[model samples]
Target: MAGTGTRLTLLLFSALGFWTLWGFPGKNNLLHFLGELSEPGASIPGPTYYPMKQKFTGIAPLDKQLTTLVGFFYTAVDGNRIDISLSFLNLGSQVLAAWILITTESYRAGNKGSFIITSTTLFGLSVVIVGYACVAPIWFALHLWTSKVVSNPRDWNIILEQPIKLAIAPVATLIGFGIPSAVMTLPAPSVISFDTKLNWSALQQGWPIWIYLAQKSLESIATWFQPMVSMRTEKQKRAEMVKYMRRAYLFALGTSAGAHLLYSGLGLAAYFLPGALSTKLQVQLQPENFFIPPNPFSDEKATTLPNGALWFLQWDLVIGVLATMIWGIAVRLSENGKQDDLGAWIKALVEYGVIAAAVGPSGAAVVAVWRRDERALKAKEE
Candidate 1:
């Protein structure tokens, strides 16, 4: 059982790692190639395209020549590759943590059933989350909540509550899903600031802030539904369960906020520092900038705004780390009072963290493949 669990966990992490590398923004050389193809006469620019311009503009005053050199590297390497690589590293860390949790649970239960049950439950929840809630509007309330404007009466409360919950709910949602709601709505600026060019302010007087806050609120509600849908274990008392769940949700919110702050700080530094400083500072450095243009142009000249940097701050690095930690901590605590070997516990923590962080929109895909294989074998035997 231990061997099987370990193998399964490793396999999931491996698949997620591959997806992080290839499926994400940086490693996708094909996306650039395809974009160039789709828009003939338009060539894909590399990441240095912006820094080069900034260097020329005297915006990169310190180490101007170094900034050009850095930009040259970014243009050569695909930005998607950078995103994928960082995601893999972060996911790898998370997987290590999840392994710890699983091992601990196994030791405590004195059997593999608890481990299997927990895995299956998480798998099921991932399916609903990635498939129905994320991909499709199968849930009417969720669909209304995510829509640009809620037309349904049922969604009215969601719209109303979104403002109040913006700061808190996004943090909670990030904890549950590892994806911050803020990223989907916000315009990417360089890591240091958000692009206000097309922001709500451009549309009208108060539209941008209102829309941003509104979307955040909706995202929060959507996130809250995930745990409720995924939770399977029953509590001895319903009230106690509700109380505990609320507390857990709040804790996740706080942890996510802290993680966001950490990631944002790194991204901010990376986006703003002149070329020379990027070389000196490794923590804030992003490899994707080495290959892809900060903004590739097809029709209009690419805007000078720092969208890529903003996206990193809002979605990619910071949110990923927070989500991984939140889920890792939750899973670990769930095994409370379990007497498991330290190694096994460590292994479980690593496994779950990897699965959550690297998989992103594909967690359900992993679960489905596993289930299908199991069913096929079962049917053949029967």
Candidate 2:
């Protein structure tokens, strides 16, 4: 056996490998499925076959080339028009944009500290990709769940024997579990703004664009009210940034895992339910394999399930709102007299909500420092 450190490294690598290979259910295995297309007469599912190869063009030539190559490869593999797989095109464009911007920035910055820049860019991109991996599947699941395709009688099964109980039971159960989970994940004010008077350059260079934008918006709202939170020293700000980054990672893992768990449980239930589905409906619904269940060891023959991840996200969001309301009320209640710090909490909430709404709740908390500096400039002018 390898040493403890070696074993740990292997374990971590294995986990990451699994994630990269099968993270988002049907989504991640595109390459594997595409490989099957290399074989003669492999049948691809869902998309209708098209003889003409599809081409994808983007804002940049390189983007156009890359997407087109991808589109062509997809068409080759599936015998389907690339345009039919709009998700891949959209994802490719966004990823291409992010890479181009990051690479441009890195190149313009020069080789003096190229390693640091490269590392940061890679880490940032990884985070972005991971965020998308979790989000896209959940979104698709939700879209599928609500679509007219699922409106058929055989598509869904009632959990309880009694019709009325079955109708409301699952929803009630979702409400009971989902709301609290969502609330607990809500970004607190501490995670939002800390009063660092960071400039625009600092913000643009250090934080994600969504975080920077949300921070700017939140700062504007705060300026309309007045200063709310206590300022942090540069050292303290750096420390807080590191802390928030870690928190963001944890939040992403938790939310994604929770979402996958929900998918797996519901999927298994639908798959195992007796007499609730006809053979045609069972094949059509694919209740066992949806969202891929976070299992890395599963083979190509894994049972497919219907996408229902979005339903989980909706429940989580409901909890987030409830949690935010509770937090807001608690802040109000805790405010004692004329010197209350309610404004700080309110500003933080605004900042949190803006970021959470723009990105997911796993979004970063402290990117509004530049806006604090902006408010300072305006104050100077006044």
Candidate 3:
């Protein structure tokens, strides 16, 4: 049997290989494909035409052409719309591969299924909580900046006739704050909250429901209050606001990277380590294979589950709802506190809500379907 050292070495190498093939270059390839799909009318010159093109464009056109070509290759492989399928597959592979690597690492670290379960459960929760937390400061900063930029009397003259816009500013700012607040208050079955008797059923109960409504109402009020609050002192507000913007940017980037690394590490360890260790042991280990549903963008339904009820619930609805909430919070918080004007604030809130509504549900839907399939596959093996 291979020693633990050998197994560790293999795991490292495997992870490195996966990252190399599917991480950096893969991202570039995906970008190239997107660019091509986005701008299909762009001409693609031959390799020999590089020197002539370089003189005119100040860069080799070959590089751009190559990216588009590679993107086209992946699109052909999927046999779907070049833009959509290529983007989906690239993202799916990156996330899935990251999870596999994380899962393997977690198992090696003696965390068991803690990595997978926590990562999956908190995936939605983190987006809502962390995402919004970061956004609050950013919005505050933006509002301050805009206020400073537009403070001049000359600028105000441009909107002298637009009294309604001025009146709407503060109200809009408060609503922007409300988005994250709503998300934070929403009931989610998290690893931490799971044992607290605050499950979905409890949340749906009278007290919880009332609390939810009250919180939403409070958030709406706060949204309106945010702009008015800033009007208290322009100088103090600008300084404080700038501080928040800086802090928020740092917080969002740092926390996001940290969270991604943590989850990815856990997922990779869970999915890959067992098989690797078994291979070293020469025991022909049939490591559990998690089901990953096919891309919804594909022609097929991509539903992997056969037990209709479980499949529908697991793959179709719950996780997606969670993801939507999380993403909604993220976008809302990210854009919050950026305006002293009610109209601008309202516009920001509406924009974030729309984005979150569309993206959150769709993203969550995909994740739920994937996780459900994984659970079902594991069950079958057992």
Q: Which candidate is the best by TM-score?
A: 2
Residue lDDT tens for model 1, 327-355 = 33322322231112556467645664554
Q: Ten-residue segment with the worst summed lDDT in candidate 1?
A: 131-140
lDDT, candidates in the order shown:
0.31, 0.31, 0.29
> For residues 64-83, could you state the per-residue lDDT of candidate 3 as single tens digits?
44333332322222222222
TM-score of 1: 0.25
Off by over 4 Å in 2: 1-7, 10-45, 48-124, 127-212, 228-258, 277-281, 284-382
**TM per candidate:** 0.25, 0.30, 0.24
Question: Candidate 2, after superposition: displacement of residue 379 in Å?
Answer: 40
Q: What would the TM-score be for candidate 3 when compared with the true structure?
A: 0.24
Ranking of all predicted structures according to lDDT, beginning with the best and ending with the worst: 1, 2, 3
Better of 2 and 3 by TM-score: 2
Model 3: residues with Cα > 4 Å off, grouped in runs: 1-231, 270-272, 275-292, 297-382
